[model samples]
Target: MLKLGVLASGRGSNLQSIIDAVEAGELSVEIEVVISDNEDAQALERAAKHQIEAQYVGPEDYNNNQDFEQAIIDDLERNDVELVILAGFMKLMSPYFIEHYQGRIMNIHPSLLPAFKGLHAQQQALDYGVKVSGCTVHFVDQGMDTGPIILQAAVPVKEDDTEESLANRILEEEHRIYPAAIKLYAEGKLEIEDGRVRIAK
Candidate 1:
């Protein structure tokens, strides 16, 4: 079984989805640990429910970004984590961390990616007046949301759509596609080829 580690902030709704997938045998993987930057993050509660180890490495305690990411790398090594999944980790990783983990790290972004790369993707979509917005799961690279895409689920941007409504819809897709990507990775069905993800039969 693949040993998976999750890094998240806030309420970890996507973290809960991974836990649920593992519990239901939908994903053939073991959750080694869950780490959060926020000490009071509700993701810790979700980890507790699964009886997995949860850690909070606060920003105040770290002298630099490297120090913070090194703590995460150390935790992954200790737990023998083969894959590091970023459910909602908001921190921008440095080149050191990116090079160390390379393709080992994965992240789920709120927008179609290669489009609105950063925060408040829903707002970006609304402001741009796009007819469609989506979510993407991809490897974490040096640039912000510039990694090769592994999975995407599109949601229509309705004429009456507000940021909140659009986000809710995208979130629903997030809950679906992220777990599916995890399942594919666990089964070794995802192969990075020519800068694109090829799903095997």
Candidate 2:
């Protein structure tokens, strides 16, 4: 089974999805640890409920981004994590950290990537008047949300949709596809080539 380290900074809805999949025996992976920069993050509580190792690594304690990332790396290595999942980690990873895990880290973004690459992605889609909006699971690279796409699920943008409404719809798809992407990685069915992801048979 693949061993996973998860990073999150919020309510952990996506993290809950992964835990649900594992508990239901739908995913073949082990959550070695769940680390959060925010001490108050609900992700930590979720992990604790599942009896998984949950830790708080405050970025404030470190002098710089590199030191913060190094602390995270040390925690991950100590747990023997094979893959890193960024469920909703608010910070952008430094190149130093990205290189250390390269192609071994995954993140779920709220918009069909290559579009709305950063925060408030649902608002971006609504502002652009897109007929369709969705979520993406992709590899984590040096650039913000510019990594190779692994999987995506599209949700129709309703004409009267508010940012919150559209975001909630997209979030459902996020909860679905993120774990599916992790499953593919766990099964050795994902390959990266020339900045794209290929799913194996």
Candidate 3:
């Protein structure tokens, strides 16, 4: 089974989905640890509920960003994590960290990607008056949300949709596709060719 180390900064709804999938026997993976930059992140609480090892690695405890990232890396390595999942981790990873886990990290973003690449993606889509909006699961590269796409699910933009409404719908798709993407990785059914992801038979 694939061993995952998850990093999150907030409510951890996505983490909950993964836990649910694992407990339901729908995903063949082990959440080895949950680490959060925020001390009060509800993700830790969720991890505790599931009896998974959870830790808080605040950046303030380190002298520099590199050191902070190294602390995270040490924790991940200690747990023998094969894959790292960013479940709404608010900070942008430094190149030092990205290089260490190249092609071994995954993140879910709320947008079609290559469209609204950075934060508040739902608001960006609504502000642009797009007819369609969705979420993307992708490999985590050095650039912000510029990684090769693994999976995406589209949601039609309703005429009266607010940012919150659109985000809620997009999050549903996020919960669905993120785990599916992880499953693909776990099954060795994902391949990267050129600059894109190619699913295997």
User: Candidate 3: where is the Cα deviation over 4 Å?
Assistant: none
Lowest lDDT block of 10, candidate 1: 186-195
**Candidate 1 lDDT over residue span 1-201, tens digit each:** 899999998899999988888888788899999999988899999999889999998878989888888999999899999999998888888999889888888899989988998999889999999999999999888899998899999999999999999999999999999989988888888888777889999
lDDT of 1 at 201: 90
Query: In terms of lDDT, which candidate is stronger, 1 or 2?
Result: 2
Error of 3 at 8 (Å): 0.2
What does the lDDT read for residue 195 in candidate 1?
75
Query: What are the per-residue Cα lDDT tens digits for candidate 3 across 75-179?
Result: 999999999999999999999999999999999999998899998999999999999999999999999999999999999999999999999999999999999
What lDDT does the true structure give each of the candidates?
0.90, 0.96, 0.96
Error of 3 at 40 (Å): 0.7
lDDT of 2 by residue, 1-201 (tens): 899999999999999999999999999999999999999999999999999999999989999889999999999999999999999999999999999998999999999889998999999999999999899999999999999999999999999999999999999999999999999999999999999999999
Q: What is the number of residue pairs that collide in model 1?
A: 0
- For candidate 2, give the lDDT: 0.96
Q: Score residue 47 of candidate 3 by CA lDDT.
A: 99
